[model samples]
Target: MIDTGEVRIQLRKGGHLKLERALGARVTSVRGTAWITAERNAGDVVILPGDSFIVPCDKLVLVGPLSGTVTLELQGARDAGSGALTHRRGPIAKLWALV
Candidate 1:
């Protein structure tokens, strides 16, 4: 378990934040709305206040505010080497596993 203090990041309009070498991050929008884009993921995500987004590992993520300034709370990266974590599967794989 990694103990970390809460961090607040402010993003101006059309501003972005680049993160590297992080397993993942738990991000919450405290004020206004934020737009998030990842390396492997297509399209942009809009998160509003009281909402959260997870930034996956091994990818570059860009977070920007849609308008005005957005206040975001970062809870740090995920734990390393936790075997319980698994990749997402398609519907076919899920059905096969049930057999």
Candidate 2:
């Protein structure tokens, strides 16, 4: 198993997402779909677009993938000041938006 202290999340941008750890997130469940995981409290999760993670493990910081040629989109954090939004560019995002 990957140790939480030595764990690193991968994003499609060839960069790492910014995250902070909480003391008692007590995440006991995490749900991942397709290629990515969404916000779930249980350490940190790496995900791609359209992926959803229901973390019931610990207080987790979610990392999503986003690039020019990527699929799936964790756009929940894209609005307001949630930081850099994870968007599945090109045709995928367009199709998802249509749905």
Candidate 3:
């Protein structure tokens, strides 16, 4: 894919993102919220336990732990490319519980 023009990537809300090794994906980091990063060659599709900052390629420069522990997940909208959100944390069902 070349920069023939301006190609935009969109990620709708509401869905579950399931990442595997084949995608070379993992929980890069997390802070109050979770952060995930997928490889550049990864397919144009992703699922999260909840909402997420769905960035493309290595745009995810920083990913910290959402909670003191680690689970690699958060709740937010899909970031067009490498971005962050301060929404909820943990599974959608147990988000407020975190607080």
Which one is best on TM-score?
Answer: 1
TM-score of every candidate relative to the true structure: 0.70, 0.24, 0.22
Rank order (by lDDT, best first): 1, 3, 2
- Candidate 3 regions off by >4 Å? 1-32, 35-49, 73-99
Q: Decide which is better by lDDT, 1 or 3.
A: 1
Kindly give the number of clashing pairs for every candidate.
Answer: 0, 26, 12
Q: State the lDDT of candidate 2 residue by residue for 1-99, as single tens digits.
A: 111221212235543332232222122212322222335533345443444444233233444434433332222211122222222332122221332
Q: Which wins on lDDT, candidate 2 or candidate 3?
A: 3
lDDT of 2 at 14: 46
- Model 1's alpha-carbon lDDT is 0.64
Cα lDDT tens digits, model 3, 23-60, are: 12233222233434445544443223443443444332
All candidates' lDDT scores? Answer: 0.64, 0.30, 0.31
